[model samples]
Target: MRAGTLIATDSGNTLAAVRRCEGSLERMRGLLWRPALVPGQGLLIAPCNSVHTIGMRYAIDVVFLDRDGRVLKVCPALKPLRMAMARGARQVIELAAGEASRLGLLPKRVVRWQETLTA
Candidate 1:
């Protein structure tokens, strides 16, 4: 999901929005490893191919997406010191942990990515 917004749904309604990252080494290094206060419609474009060793004050749900923005893997409540790997993922989105379960996101579930007017 190249530099786009990730809309998580709960009960068929949008619950949270997370910026999609390409998971490049440069992008990963550029991103703040701390908890971020992103507003509604916020987005963080990443340059890498995956995210690793995320250290934040709170746990977050991670969604691994393929080149087509398809949901490849979902790791709910990913706590600090925990690691999630996306073998076939081209991008990874970090959302508030447990958001995945609340959104009923599971393997094989397809996530749709809509391009915003602004980056």
Candidate 2:
């Protein structure tokens, strides 16, 4: 998975630092063994509309995005063993619990993914 960040183009503010989990294996392993995501950290699963937290160690905020990076839905503080989905969503971002709200990632807001510099 390649690391990146989600930024609001309108405000030029960062929403979160994320890793692109595009492959099936990568998406399947989503937050399974993680204790919790630190602030500003998240996972991006492309071509996804639904997600399950059956084996996640901690709750998370699920932000659904349309093909154009528009926020479609947000499932906040989704606890373990839960699932969330949004119609017409092309990607899902698994953020730390409350991270979406803290970053103002509300429905209709726009965000763009940018690959950050890596050493």
Candidate 3:
């Protein structure tokens, strides 16, 4: 996964270091066979409306975002084997449990992601 920062455009706050995971293979392999994300780490899956924790070992905070990057919904502390979905969502951000609460991610909050250059 390529790394990046999620920033709240309104408050200018850096939400976390969220890795970008695109393509079918990457999206399908999300959080599976992966270690638990640190407090300030997350995964951003684009063109995703729903997610499942079928093989995930740790809980996660799921944030659904619209095309314009406005938050549409949040499912916090989603445990393993659970599933989450949001209508009208164009992307989803999976964060460490409680990380969304820590960042105060709410509906309508505009969050922008900036990719970090990797050598």
Ranking by lDDT: 3, 2, 1
Give the per-residue lDDT digits (tens) of candidate 3, residues 4-117: 999999989888999999688999898899999999999999989999998888899999999999999999999999999999999999999999989989998999999998
lDDT for each residue of candidate 2 in 1-119, tens digit (9 for 90 to 100): 88999999899988788989868988788888866888989999988999999977788999999999999999999999999999999999998899999999999999989998878
The global C-alpha lDDT for each of the candidates, from Candidate 1 onward, is: 0.56, 0.91, 0.93
Winner on TM-score (2 vs 3)? 3
Off by over 4 Å in 1: 1-15, 21-26, 29-49
Clashes of each: 9, 0, 0
Worst 10 residues of 2 by lDDT: 26-35
TM-scores for candidates 1 onward, in order: 0.64, 0.94, 0.95
Model 2 segments beyond 4 Å from truth? none
State which candidate has the highest TM-score. 3
RMSD of 2: 1.1
lDDT agreement of model 3 with the native:
0.93
Q: Relative to the unseen true structure, what is the C-alpha lDDT of residue 39 in candidate 1, on a scale of 0 to 100?
A: 31
Candidate 1 lDDT over residue span 65-118, tens digit each:
776656788777667666777887866666655566766667766665555466
| Candidate 2, backbone clash total | 0
* lDDT of the structure predicted as candidate 2: 0.91
